[model samples]
Target: MEDLSIQHVHLELSENLEAHRTQGFSNANALVVRRGAPFRVSVQLKGRPFNPTTDYLRIRVSLGRLYVLMPVTFSRRAPSSRWSAHIDPTTSNKQTLFISICAPASSPVGSYRVQLSVFTQDRQRSAANGSFILLCNPWCSEDEVYIPFEDQREEYVQSDSGLLFKGTPMNLVSRPWSFDQYEPGVLEACLNLLQVSPQHKRNRTKDYRNRCDPVYISRVVSAMINCEDDRGVLKGNWSNDYKQGVSPSKWTGSGDILKQWAQSGFSPVKYGQCWVFAAVMCTVMRVLGVPCRVVSNFNSAHDTNDNLVIEEYYSETGQKMNLSKDSIWNFHVWVECWMSRRDLGSEMDGWQVLDPTPQERSGGVFCCGPAPVKAIRSRRIDLLYDVPFVYAEVNADVHTIILGQGQVVGFSKDTEKVGSLICTKAVGFPRLQNITGDYKFIKGPTSTISSMSSTMSEDSTTSRGSSKGVLVSLSLDKSPVAGEPIRFMVKVMNKQSVTKRLKVHVNAQAKEYNHSPSDTFWENHAVLQLAPMEVTVLRNQILPAQFEHVDEDILINLAAVLEDMSSHERFLASEEFNITSPELIVQVAEESIVPNKDHAATVSFTNPFPHPVSGVLTVTGAGLIHGKTQFRMSTLRPGGRIEQNVTFNPSMAGVKMLQASLSLSDRNIVIRGFTMVHINRV
Candidate 1:
């Protein structure tokens, strides 16, 4: 094959339901459908209509190497149109052809090559040659899941989120992770993850069970894709690569991760966190004919027990203690699989939650979920697998244990924060759909949260305590760069009338974020005296070595211990900061360039990491190299310097923005830079 071209075919469920449209112009693009369903498509042709040699036009559908041709058939008021031997346009000149593909009820979901044109024994011409994805609809078979055309373009094929690396995951509903699933590497890796190799199979039936069994397949993929098992493809050691200069905070797509895994002789892809694990799992599930979407739960809880209560111990000085297994992550990413739980009743069907992050064990295995979110929200712990654990993640109550000298002091109850902003991509669109209300129902037989609760201790319930006399808080700087001094602030206010003498101790620890808390990495202490109702702010700086631990990944945990010396009462506050490396500095040869004049953009950076890394620098903006340019990069040794120069000419004059990023081959690491220049008219 010398070349290939892709064209988009605007598809809709019906003329009335025009809101549902699907099209793609790359191998990475596809029109998704469910197998054995009334999947109909109206093909609207782009470009000029070709004169047909014959009276009848035919559609040649190719699956693998096999090809079958069917004549373009549809009922119109005029019967002559279907009977005509040459199905070319009449004088009226209509280019649109209506195609109703009748796939059997049990047709295997996959991709197919469809060519719509007028063909004869002597020759054949191409009108529309494109591919489509057949997804498994285990529910009622009528395609309830509607995928928008924009989603097919950006959400399915484009993997990077609009937000840059180290951006907060809190406001991610505004950003989309366009996952390009059709990439060759991603497709291959997905197929390879199945137990039965695709090459060894005779046809679709060879491994139908291993391929379509949602429960079994999900479990195998959840474990096998993460190196929790020796047979897994990727090792999910989070702290290893994340906090270090490596590991892009957000994943680009599945292809890069898949490519890296293959290069390592199938050794596990290194150091994936929850989002990385979830994104890869989404690709695998989608490629395997299972419809999947990545979901982000802000303030998601990790309930250690079946109980939904999350308890936290804190020193009277406001320092949070790390004693409970119950905790809430700022945000958690997991995948929701669309499939019928045939094993369960009709009520349990649809949208099964499958977490590939390996947070907790299910059935003595490192895999979790296939547990129905409906079951979890409905408080149906009676259902199979891990419903209770997932319920607590969304509905756990927070109990803050305040203690002085290792004994419990006054307690604070916080119901805010955990399990809010539960969202997923809306159907038939590329925006967020908040289904938080789906989990907000009160607990009962009708109570989803309470019924899912197997046990509730006294600590589980609490009435928030009254405010303490003084206020003390600890906070880290917005962005702390590695190899530099990190700054933090301690704010204290003595609201009482009398003077206050406060003993303040601030400790900075390097913690392995994805796992249990590690030992303290550094410490600082100071005592202060303040006048009545005085509000004082103290700023402190920690040396680079203090928070930089030997672990490949690190999180700076700052704890502030405040003591009222006169009363001997204490309060505690803490904050966590993810240390980001310095930005990749972009230096342009000149600040101004005339039209048609070439200018150089030198993207320079030093590898702050210990190992050698290879990557590509991509430059893109409105008027640069047809709007995009990619330059391959060589590997750089530890602490090596890279000053890549890319030259581009300004065809038009104005202010132009240049966006460049140094992205590693596997895309585990990415450093971004941007520059704007005035383009002088020649």
Candidate 2:
């Protein structure tokens, strides 16, 4: 009888093992999975084929220190999205086999190495090896992402969310923005950010908070957020002297950011504020299969010290004092991640905060959180991460101080303004969920304001905070059309019993939303005289060119300050508006196509403005184009129409979404359009 000993054994891993080999898939640490999901490892053997009735296939799986040994059975059916081949030992000399394993709840998250051997007789043993990484199965009820949630499932699953960008206090939160978490480069970037060192690559499965750990991944993001490195996004210089000289309109999605970052050789991408940082971070998290959401905290305090109060000192003439070390952003954005709290205790498991913006430093680095939301809510300040800092952002009070003749004059506090709205994307809807009560003590209505009189003799010269005295209101006249004047009305009231003189300043600036407003495109200054309890209205208009950049989305930020010259009390308030670009229209010849057949698609648009545009058009879709296809075009004359045609063949059977984007590089104009094509299997 022929010996059952195997001549040679080789192993590889991928859903498409053949294609993976052809594409040079050589990542030693490439395998990634969640518990309960089937992980497939492919094995190929060539030898004197042993009869399966006499020989057996034995496999050993090693996850860091944990190990499992199991026997493999031959099957003709292929695994889902995977390749498996049957071995007819009597006729076939070469055989390929797929071993699919599902990790149970007790299995820890980490890299797994597998060894396969054919052993039937006691004298023969032949082996081959391969490996993969595993994570907590968030989709399973046994995991933290689904275990603790009673809310609808969509909020935790949606890739697109609503954010309030253009309104007073950001009350309007339903403008839809996509997260595009499944972009290929986003996952690559997240992995590259985490596995930076060789040690990280070597010892990834050792600890929950180790270098390859998700917590460590979040930390790497923070340290890299200064916009000074290859993957950095925001340039966070809070000093009065810095300016974002270039404006790149509103980003379409996080995929754009990751693509730009990767294309630039990992160099710093332009213009990211808190929301931009939060939004992109949300994309990275979700792309890596982590459940994440963007959260906005209005009147977010940058409490320099551990104390939960941001103090503001104003001059007698009612000008804001920038004298304090503490600062409060108008609104601050951060990300909340879902995971089991292995670092903290069980009760702390839920949403953990992870800030990617270059804020204050922690542990000698610029990262923050994975600080448990439960811990922040319960006032557990002594945790390992920045609990006190995050707590201050959501629950701190704004302590306002007024000074007259360089001395303490008045003291006031605003509780409602800080953390007024804590919002995330509404589950399964195009709306926002206000989760403010989740952060604050909501049993009784929290106090909005508290005031006290302090002696002017004491030295109150050093305090500075954020305030727009007594909730002043500003109104916009009408919606702004592109290439049209922007108009707004500012109304100030003299609430005292006597007549008073007021110094009112209206500053209107055009800024991109991804950066702070620094340039004043238009301004109006006036000294007005008002009677007791009288209202004064100032109407201001700015020309279209003032707010319009060459080819960028302009954000109109209006800051109006009404200062009481006699009483030295001031009211400062601000509002925001959006200027949008025209859309690119796409019309398809047909809605459906048969598999392996070609369909023609046409995209067209007119240049409404006087200037000509020059750029590349990037077309992308899954199962349509093999990858993204780009076409370059130069200046067509002013008012010229751009109509182009491209042919796409369906590779698989399914509904496919095809999108085209025209990026005017020099002029910075972006026009996007999409259409759906059905690929029917015949």
Candidate 3:
């Protein structure tokens, strides 16, 4: 007899086996069987050690041409073991079970290997590893073998749920992947795939907010703008060729018709044609789910040209279309979109003309020629579409058309029935031609007044008297130092006229350190003049004192006070010019020294001028003691003096070279009566 001992037996299950069992046998067990023999296999389950009351088992054996396996079920109340009788024993304690087999008498005989598998709700086992084999008669005919081929017509079996395919599936051919190939349904499929996983679903909200594909509406709007110069010829023609066949369902009545045309490849120019084109394009964009509007202005100037130009178009008959150019007749048009608001807030409300014409008369029109075969001449105005115009002042009668949610549709020198209109009051513009006058000092409460004449038009008038009696008093809460902020208040009251507006320009100039003998003081200027009779506070930091032992002058220059104009042709004072001190000078004193310990000395400083003196009194020299170096002082008056004690320590016992100096502004002045001392150490 051959050795039949089983070695390395391993039992595994798909899920927890013990938790689902309550009877005579645990699901985690291996089965032993013999080849070429029929055997009855039975299993009896025993309850867990703690609960031994239940003992049950069930085993079934069947022989058929085909095999169908179902999950094993358990009933806890049943206590007896179930049995099936279908086993054939060929040797001592050696038997096998004929699970399923289909073979004819004519089949060729050979040893056949078969795999027998058993499955429960949570477990599965197979016996194919050197455990099972079948032997057939050597004289069996080949006709007994059943093998299927591709020649049979295959049909899918349909149930209440869905179609099912039979037979083994073949591998599909490979191709390159493309995102564009994904259909609308693919998006839903992707969403479903993402949701199937719990972890992915948990992060879905965050991913949607951060990684969601943003719609680039600007690209679509850019395509519709169509700023080509050739389409400018279609301005105002309103022909079918110039109009885009947009469905009314897409566009609202308030939309610009010309914007629609331009977006649909109609208008292509900046002047009249471009305006009309932009209007149509805007309308078309609105129809395409993009809300848009139009804007119009008169005497508009282009930044490039710095002048205003009229927008005109040539007819198909080679005749020029004349547009009104009078103050009331000049016009311009531009289109804007709501998407701009998403990117640019309130500024997006303004219209951006597709092809903007130059607003200046000196600027020429942008020329455009048709293709060689078309033989057409045209011009396009290239204007920035997204620029914002915060303020607009008109001096003539002008008409503006607003379309598509308050978008300006048309700007015309000529009034249209549906457009907004505004009229400007006629007034002469201001100009400065000549300002060549001499300054003269006068005594008394008023400074000298010079007669000034202007070449403004006779109809022009001036009001508000000069600020001749204005007085500016400067005070400091605390004395100012170099690199510190100084506060000042300017006061003006006495005025020749009260009705006129006043504007003042104030500047301060001082002598720079190390200035050449011929070089005057450098003047730093600042202007402050918005309201009259109101005190204006000014703050500034002072530069470091650059010169020592010398007088420095601070000069304040007040420019001419301009007054607001009235109905009559005359000049009046807006405020009085009562500046108390136009210039202030202060004298810095020389340094004097007193002897101290170990060749150290104390230096005193005084200010000769009545005004307070502010500066750093630093003492620097070679072989000076550490921590005895620099000192800062402020507000030294005419009779007040500040003393600073400094010590010098020589490293070696010998005469040490020492030099004391003071830095004021950028100039360095040496202190007198200081000598090198010889140190003798015993």
Estimate TM-scores for all models. Answer: 0.61, 0.70, 0.18
Tens-digit lDDT track of model 2 for 20-86: 1111122332655655455555555555555567778777777555567766666645443222224
RMSD of each: 10.7, 7.9, 36.7
Quote model 1's TM-score.
0.61
**lDDT for residue 129 in candidate 3, whole number 0-100:** 31
Candidate 2's clash total is 5
Index of the highest-lDDT prediction: 2
User: Residue by residue across 45-94, what tens digits does model 3's lDDT show?
Assistant: 11221111221112222221222222223322221122122222231122
Q: What is the C-alpha lDDT of each candidate?
A: 0.58, 0.59, 0.25
- Candidate order by lDDT, decreasing, is 2, 1, 3
lDDT of 1 by residue, 1-682 (tens): 1111113454443431211121211223345554543444555544445333343456666555545566764332232112111222332233555445544334444456877664433454446676655545433344222233444333332322222122223213232232334443555455556533322243544444234356766777777667775456656655454563236344444566776776666667666777777877877776555567777775678887756778877554444568887776756778877656767876877678888887787777777888887898788888886788778778888776667776775454556546655777664444566666666563333322111111111111233232336676665554566557777678887767889898887776655444344566677788899898898988999876555453323455567767778766666666555556445676779866887777888878787755577888776553443435778879988788988787878655544555576776643445666665567867
Ranked by TM-score, the better of candidates 1 and 3 is 1
Candidate 3: Cα lDDT at 23: 10
lDDT for model 2: 0.59
Runs in model 3 deviating more than 4 A are 1-275, 298-329, 340-342, 345-682
